[model samples]
Target: MLITFIISSALLTLITLAPLLPSNHWTVRVWEFPRLQIVFLILINILLMALLIAQDLGPFLALVIVNLCLLCYQINWIFPYTPFANTTVKMSKSSDLSSRIKVINVNVLMSNRDAHKLIALVEQHQPHLLVTLESNQWWQDALEPLHDAYPYRVNYPLDNLYGMHLFSRIPLSDITTAERVEQGVPSIHCIANLHNGKQIQCHFLHPAPPSPTENEESTERDIELLGLAREIANKQGSDSLPVLVSGDLNDVAWSPTTQAFLRISGLQDPRIGRGAYNTFHAQYAFARWPLDHIFHSEHFELVSLSRLSEIGSDHFPLLTEIHLK
Candidate 1:
């Protein structure tokens, strides 16, 4: 019994930590560490109680190490989401409409070569802005017809997995990429000018997954995103500015790390109460979670959000429209 408990507890801890390893699928991977931790703690407590009932101090003392591990796990789990509340009580603000913006973010696999489907999605949604990840020159050339409609463009096509491109019908300004952490990986950050002359900062990101073929760990990608969120949150009146951080975040909405990012950045998820609109590996519908996300500051209200039909890519495009206050 002692050996069984020791082995099972150790195995659970190892499985919980396994996601720390790199993998392209790490973004959507669900590591139920919290539940595992709870299970172990409950088991340990029950064991101690049983031993105490039998008046056998040996087994109780023997399980001391496992108890300590559970304590540590609980400590980490207790970390707060974010310092800011969901909505500020001091500022009872109404939603914005003049600053409305619609965006489409898609990770069109480089090998997809099905630009026609992408074009159809664009024509159907008519998003104010469109950002594509894993897009190469082939994708850039395929999407040429869109340039005529969406005059503003930012193309940083790379053969590397991090290729990114952006097209917007609205005027965009202050366009720049975070070159430091986003080496070969390309991201588009800019300010969009609405019809009402409202300017909102938009960021499109597609970080490398933590796969053996890609990054060794998701820490760098996760940290970079969290850092950006913190920067946005620190900005005074950031909520009023109507900032949007969207893309193939490669992380699920339920992940603790992803939730922390949302809290620290003062961003609100549009998918609250919405079903998990999984986007990746569309072929395997059952194995899907909401990998792509659109997180925005408080000033906007979600008008529409959905996943488009498959377009010969592992990922399905996500479209979100928000009325900006």
Candidate 2:
């Protein structure tokens, strides 16, 4: 029992410090996703060590101190997302419908055939904008009915899982499909003309993730994200246009890359004080993280943010409502 406790503690400690290294290798970056899970394991480790307290006070005390420090470190990064923490984006009290924009972002697994489930959500929410990732030609055909409701559209359907589609009820202008890093993977940029005569710059992205099969390193993903951040920062400096960036970033909210993107883009995360709003791996309750995200400039205030029901995909849809302030 003591040996098992020691091994678990050692492994947990290693995982806690692995991401601290300055490496973009998939092995290192993948460790960043399971911080919450690690926290849970740490608690269990502490409890097990407490049960073996009679064995040796010295080693037990050492392990407890190290685990406590790691716990604090992990909590510090995720603290802002907890309900106890103050919200980064202010709540909106406005009742004006024209100034409000409700968006639904989903990563429909390329192979998943239950398109009707997502169609149901669009019908139920009646969102101003809908963004889908991993959408192929078949998925596009499946969602053809949405054309009437979402007249302004930018479709870039591909067999590759990085395919994206942006459908909007609001008038979209200056729409462009950009490949920031890789040639095939594309990102969407457009201007959404709100009913209140306000225009917001919207960016939709579905960057490749660092994984054994997808990307051995996070270089391309980081380059794409940071490049967009720099452009948004430059544009925001001259004109404070309300900017909305949403999609499957393929990076967790607490990751260093995502944090850098937030800092550079000057966009606010609505999930910061509300909840994790985990959207990926919908089939697995224990193995889920917030891979999908909706970030907007400070010019918008939060109306509501929620994780919608499963749609037969690995990722659940993320529904967000923000008021253009």
Candidate 3:
């Protein structure tokens, strides 16, 4: 029994290392999805090893050491998301309420038929801009009431899970629907003119995840992020306008791809000092990571960010308020 336990711990350690390879295959890419689970298992394995340590002193000690090493590595990846880490974006202390803009993002799971909860949330928040993904014609009709309050709209309501719709009460100009990396997947890009006479370039995306049911590899997802990052990078400047990018990114905030995108685009995540605010798999708290993201350039400071109530979807809506600096 002791030998079997040791082998099990060693196997878990190897599984944690599999993601270190440079392969984008679904099997390898998926390792990034369960870091939290791996960390938990590592801890439990260590405690079990301690109880069994008296059985085989040397071997069990080695097992505990290995688990500790893996635990440190996993924690290092996730520590920046806790309040202990410095925030990537400065918090907004500006008292100018007019300069503040609130944006809400929701991935209304395509198969979810109920829209009453979603509609209610909209009525309650009444954000300056509301972005929705995986919305079909049915959703479009159900959300028609938005047109009354939100005069400006950019919509691509398709049965495809990648459909996107942007509703804004503020002025939206130069709106464009782009199929940057894949045809079925669409992204919304436009300029949001704030009441303070400032323009915020906005981009909303929902890239495909690496799963057996979806793409077999993460190449498309990686490419889509890189392309968007490059576009944002090109626009980076000292006197450039503020830019906001948000949606169900379908990737963890701590993944290499996400970090690389931040470095390339020079955008900041408000969740650095804040908690994970993990939005995906809303029903499973322990199994959640930050999949829905809101990233912005240095031109804006954080006001408030939180995960709103569920809307019969797998993801919880993300609400972020920022003040242009």
Measured by lDDT, the strongest candidate is 2
Which digits, one per residue and each the tens of the lDDT, describe model 1 over residues 1-325? 5666567566656655555555425432445323333545546665654665456656656455555565566444433222322422122243554566889989898888889999999999899999898899999999999988999999988888678899999999999976547578767889999989888888888876665677756766777788788888788472457788998887766666678888898888776655456787778854665678888887777677788999888999999888875
For this target, which candidate reaches the highest TM-score against the unseen true structure? 2
Residue 221 shift from truth in candidate 1, angstroms = 0.7
Over the stretch 1-325, how does candidate 2's per-residue lDDT look in tens digits?
Answer: 6577678878988888889888989998898998889988898888777776857767578778878888899888888878998889999999988999999999999999999999999999999999999998999999999999999999999998988998999999999998878878999999999988999999999889999999899999999999999999998765668999999999999999999999999988999878999998899999988999999998989899999999999999999999987
Worst 10 residues of 3 by lDDT: 52-61
Model 2 misplaced regions, further than 4 Å: 54-56
What's model 3's TM-score? 0.97
Evaluated at residue 188, the lDDT of candidate 1 is 81
Q: Candidate 2 versus the native: TM-score? A: 0.97
What are the lDDT figures for the candidates, one per model?
0.74, 0.91, 0.89
Candidates ranked by lDDT? 2, 3, 1
The local lDDT score (0 to 100) that residue 57 gets in candidate 3 is 68
Q: What lDDT is reached at residue 79 by model 2?
A: 84
TM-score of each: 0.74, 0.97, 0.97
Clash pairs, model 2 backbone: none
Compute the lDDT of residue 67 as modeled in candidate 1.
Answer: 56
Q: Predictions ranked by TM-score, top down?
A: 2, 3, 1
